[model samples]
Target: METRKKILITIGDPAGIGPEVALKAFLQFHDKAIVFVGDADVLSEAAALLKLNLAIRAVDSVSEAIFDKGILNIIDVGALRGLSWQKCVPTAIGGRASAQFIRCAVEIILNGGAEALVTAPISKEALMLGGVYYLGHTEMLAELSGATDYAMMLTGGRLRVILATIHTAIRNVPDMITLGRILGVIRHANTAAYMLGIIAPRIAVAGLNPHAGEAGMFGREEIEEIAPAIEAAALEGISVTGPHPPDTIFHKAYNGEVDIVVCMYHDQGLIPLKMIAFDRGVNMTIGLPFIRTSPDHGTAYDIAWQGRASATSMAEAIKMASTLRLPTWR
Candidate 1:
C-alpha cells in the first residue's frame, strides 16, 4: 500500500528520445508508482525498438492501472495511431501529441489524482509547429495551472540554480530583469529550497554583467536592479546574498557555500549544471501549485530512437518528483 500519491509522467515529443528515455526510466523505477500520460503506441514502439519486452497497458486512471512485474500502466492522451512520424526530427504531429500529453497530465494532477509530474524532453520549435504556442514545459504548466509567478530551476548532484529569465533572447534579457522579477525568482528559490526540505537556505544571486558589473563599469543592471532585489529579499528575513560575479557564484554553490544559486539568465545557470550533471540533472518549476519536474535534457534529435539516449536524467526526475509534494508557492 504505497500511500504516497502517484507520479504522473508525460512522454515528451513523439519524434524524439522522450518516449525511449521515458519508457526506459519507467522500468528502472516502476515501483515508485507512476502513470504515463502519453500515446501507448508510441511507448510500445519505443520499447520494441529498444528491444524491451515489458508489458505496457493503458488505463483511464491510476486505480484502473494494472501494475505487475512486467507491466507498465499508461493513460493514453492522444490517438496518434497510424501517424507517420520521423525519428530525430521535430514534426507538427509530434508536437501536438506531446502538448496533449502535457495537458492531460496537468489535468490529472490538478484534480488530486497525483502529487507530482515528470515530463520528458520536448522541442520548442516542434511545439510551435504543432500549434501549441507556449515556449516550453515551464510556460505551458504555468499557464495551464494558472500560476503567474513561477521560476524554472535545475538541480543535480550538489548544485541547484533558479533562472530569473527563461526562454528569451539575449538582447531581450536586460529588459526582463526588472527588480520585481528578480525578487519573485528569489522568493521562488526560497520556496524551492523548502520543497527540498532545506531550512534557512543560503541564497546566492548571480550578477548580470561581467565582474558583477564592476560596480557599474560593465553594466548598471547589478547596481540598479539585481542588488536591490537581493537587499529587499534580505530585509524580509531571507538569508540572501549577492549579485556575485556569474563566473564564480556557481563555483560557490557547487562547493556548498550556498544552498542555491539564483542565476540571472538561462545559460548562466544551465551551462554549469549540464556540463557536470547532464546525465542526472532534474529541472523543477517553482511557484507552481503542484510539483513539476522534468529531465534537464532536451529532445536529443541527433540520437533519437537509436537506443543511445540515456535514461539517467529521466529516472532522476521521477525520483525527485516522487519525493517532493506540492508546496505553497509564496
Candidate 2:
C-alpha cells in the first residue's frame, strides 16, 4: 500500500479557535497523517472542550510520525504561559506563540519534512502586538520562501478569484491597477490553473471601474491598462478574456463560463466568492515556489473557545493542498 502524505497543520493563536477547528478537521479526515505544529497543551484542552477521543504524541520531526488511527502527532511548541482563554483579549504570550508556530511550520516545509502546509486562521493584530512586523501569512511566507511575485487566489467549488492587489485600500486600487500589475496577475492565474490540472484555463479579467469603465467614460483604466494586459496574455497563447464588468464577470465565472476571474481589487473578487461559498472557501497563494493554503476566514476571537468555530474551510484547504503539487523552487 502507498504511504499517506504528511501535511503540517498549524493551529494558530491559542487564544482563538485554531485548535478546535484543527481537531475537528483531523477527526473528519482520519486517513491522512497530519502533524499538528503548535502547543500540545492547547490542543489537549481544545480536544477536551470538544469532547473528542484522541491522543497527542510529541514528535521531533515529520519523518518520525506513524500514521495511526485516532492519534494526532504534534511538534510541541509549548503552551502559553499566563494566558487566559476566558475572553478573546490578546496577550503577549499568545501573540508570541502564534508567530513561533508560523516560523516553525515554514521551517518544517523548507526541510522537506512536510509535503504541504494547511494553516488555520490567525489574528493580524495579535501578531503585531506580539512584535511580528509582517502583513499576514501570505506575505510572510512569500518573504521567507524568497518568492518574488505572487497573488492571492480564493477558491470555492465553482467560483474562483485571483486578485491583482490584496490588502490595499479601495481608494488606492485605481492607481494600483497598472498594465504591468494586471499582466502579472494574469500570468499567476494561468500558472495556478495549470497546477490544478487545467491545460488551457479560460480566464476573465474584471475591470477596476463600474461597467468596465463604460468605454473610458467612467475611467480609462479598462482601455489603457486592463485591455492591454488581456491582449498581451492572449498573444502568449493563453485563453484570456475580458475587461468585463465586475458585476457580470463573477456571475459568469461562477456559472462555468470561465475557469478563473482576475479581479483588480480585494473586495471585487472576495465579495462574490465569499457570498457564494464563504463557509468552505480556500485561500491559495499563487506564483509562490511552494504550495501554501489557508482558511478563508479569520481568527474569530468573539467565539473563541465557545465550540462555535467551523472546520469546513480548513478541511477544504487541506484537501486542496493534498491534491496539488508544488512547483520546484530554485
Candidate 3:
C-alpha cells in the first residue's frame, strides 16, 4: 500500500465549477488525507445540486480533520452563508472568496501543515473585480511563495509542455523570449522531469517561427535566442535538442521522440496540449518550494451549477498531486 500524504485543495472560484468538481473528486478517491479549503456552504450547495448524499465535516485546523472514505472534510475560509448560487457569478464577493481560499491554502503549505496543494480554477475577471491584481494562479503562486525562477508545466497523457513565456501578450512574447529566459525554462523543465522520475529525459525546444525562422529569414528569435538556449542546456547535460519547427515538433513528441517540449509562447504549446488532453490535462508549477498542481482548464461559469461539469481534470489533479508527493520509485 502507498503511504498516505496530506494534500491541500483550494476551491478556486465559489461561483464556478470548482466546488462541484472538488466534491466529485473526493467522492471517488479516498486514499490520501485531502483537506478542501473553501466555503463549506458552497460545497454543500454543490452536493445538493448533484443530488448526492455527501458528508461534509468542518474542521478548525488542518490537523483536526479526519481523512476517511465518504466524508469531505472542509476548512471553511469564506463566509458564504447568505450568498446564493445565482449571485456566485463573477461578482466581487465571489472573487474575494476565491482569493481568500487560495491564500488560505498557500498558508497551510507554507506552515508545514500540508505536503502538496491542488488548486481548482479561478476567474481572472473576478480576481480583478475583487481587488486582487494577480492575473491567475501561476503569477499569484510565484509571488506568494517568493519564487523568482518558476515555469508553468502542462502534462496530459504522453504530452508535456513547459512554457518559456506565459500569460503575456502575443506582441510582447518576442521581447520576453531572451536567452536567459529560455535557458531558465530549460532548467526548470529539467527539474520537473526529475520530480516525475524521468532522469535523463529527452527535452525538445520549439522554434519561434516557421521552419525555425528559415535560418533567420522569417525571424531571428530562433537562430539568435532559441538555438543558443538549447546549446547551453545541452552543455549542462540535459539531453536537449531543438529549435525544431513548431509545426512538426508536436508530432515528434506524440511519437515518443521527445519527453518534454519547450515552447516559446503560450498558444504554441497549449493549442496542441488541449487538443490531445482536453479533459485530463494537469497544470503544474516547477521550481516552487512545495509541489503544486491544478486542472489545466479554467472556471466554466457557463455550466457552473448545472451539474454538467466533468470532474476528470479535478480527479487527475488530485491523483497527480498524490503521486508527486510520493517518493519516486525509480
**Root-mean-square deviation of each candidate, in angstroms?**
1.4, 1.8, 2.4
Which pairs clash in the backbone of model 2? none
The digit string of per-residue lDDT tens for model 2 on 6-111 reads 7889998888878888888888777787899998888888899999889888889887777788898999866564555434666666777888887888888888
Residue-level lDDT of model 3, residues 1-330, one tens digit each, is 324678989988888889888888878787779999998888888899998787999997778887777888899985566765454478777778888888888888889888899999999998898899987999998888788888999998779999999998999988888899999999888888888888679999999989989988999998789999889988988888889999999999999889999999999999999999999999999877788999999889988888889999999999988887332431
Quote each prediction's TM-score. 0.96, 0.95, 0.95
Lowest summed-lDDT stretch of 10 residues in model 2? 78-87
Report the number of clashing residue pairs per model: 0, 0, 0
Ranking by lDDT: 1, 3, 2
Model 1 RMSD vs true structure: 1.4
Clash pairs (backbone) in predicted model 3: none
Candidate with the greatest lDDT versus the true structure: 1
Model 1 lDDT tens row, 1-330? 658568888989988999999988888874677888999988888999989988888898987876566788899876487787777899898888889898898998888888889999999999888888998999999999999989999998889999999999999998888899999999888888889989889999999989999989999999999999999999988999998999988888889999999998899999999888979899999888888999988999999989989999999988888777556534
Candidate ordering by TM-score (highest first): 1, 3, 2
What would you estimate as the lDDT of candidate 2?
Answer: 0.85
Point out the worst 10-residue segment of candidate 1 by lDDT: 321-330
Best by TM-score: 1
